[model samples]
Target: MADVLGLYNYWVVIFLMMTGFYIVISRRNLIKKVIGLSIFQTSVFLLYITIGKVRGGTAPIVADGFEVYSNPLPSVLILTAIVVGVATASVALALVVRIREAYETIEEDEIFEQDR
Candidate 1:
């Protein structure tokens, strides 16, 4: 039970990831799909950050008293990913706006029906 409790964060990550994936796959609205992708991206970020955490660890700075220094690479990478994710989401939203303008509806099935 204690061992299972220790992995709570991982379990949360898994749940969020699956929920996001299910939203993306099952939703028909373009805006909803983008939201789902954002959720999925956020879960990935959480997973990476969680993985980077160290018990009894300090920041990766050289100090005489500190020995267990946490790695900074994962944090740095996540920062970059956050920037990219925001940009991608903005682009996706812009595309969705354009799609709504052209199709008069943001629903995937409606757009397809119009096309046909």
Candidate 2:
């Protein structure tokens, strides 16, 4: 039962990642593309958190009477990645807003046309 639940969680993370990638690559709207990129980034965050989770491990912080501590490296890495992701998302969103204001439309093709 526990193994099945774990496998299911893994599958969900993979599905989210694939879907997010497909959206980012295939979508045409600028805002939609940013949304997709955010989703993809978040899916990666989820993956990191999932991997960091231990079946029966304790926190890495040294305290009183602690035996097994799960690895904290993954959590720390994910925290950094999440901050970077937010920065990227903010920049992308700002770019999309600028594109919309400049071209009067958020469609990728329209923006390209205005650029040319």
Candidate 3:
């Protein structure tokens, strides 16, 4: 029970990942797919933060009394990833807007049918 509770973050990550994947695959609306992708991206971010956490760890800085310093690389990388993810999501939404404008619909199946 203790072990399972300790890994709760991982369980949440798995749940979010699956839910996002399902939404992306099962939904026919392009907006829904984009939202699903954002959820999936959020799960990845949570997973990384969970992995980087350390018990009784201090910030990665030179201190006189601190010994167990947590590594900052993961957090730094995640920050950069968040910026990139936002840009990517914005671009995806912009494309979706353009697609909607061109096709007069945002449904994936409808768009495909129109193309056909």
TM-score of candidate 2 on Cα atoms, chains taken together = 0.82
Question: After superposition on all CA atoms, what RMSD does each candidate show versus the true structure?
Answer: 1.6, 2.2, 1.6
Model 2 poorest 10 in a row by lDDT: 48-57
Instruction: Please identify model 3 stretches exceeding 4 Å from their true place.
Output: 59-66
For model 2, which pairs clash?
Answer: none
| 2 or 3, greater by lDDT | 3
lDDT at residue 45 of model 1 (Cα atoms): 96
What is the full ranking by lDDT, best candidate first?
Answer: 3, 1, 2
lDDT of 1 by residue, 1-116 (tens): 98998799999999999999999999999989999999999999999988888889988779898889777888999999999999999999999999988989999999999999
Q: lDDT per residue, candidate 2, 1-116, as tens digits?
A: 98897688779988999998999899998888888888888888888878887868887898888877877998899889989888988998898788778789999888788788
Where in model 2 is the C-alpha error above 4 Å? 1-6, 113-116
Which pairs, if any, clash in model 1? none
Ranked candidates (TM-score, high to low): 1, 3, 2
Between candidates 1 and 2, which one is better according to lDDT?
A: 1
Question: Candidate 1, which segments miss by more than 4 Å at Cα?
Answer: 61-65
Error of 2 at 106 (Å): 0.7
- How well does each candidate superpose onto the true structure, as a TM-score? 0.89, 0.82, 0.89
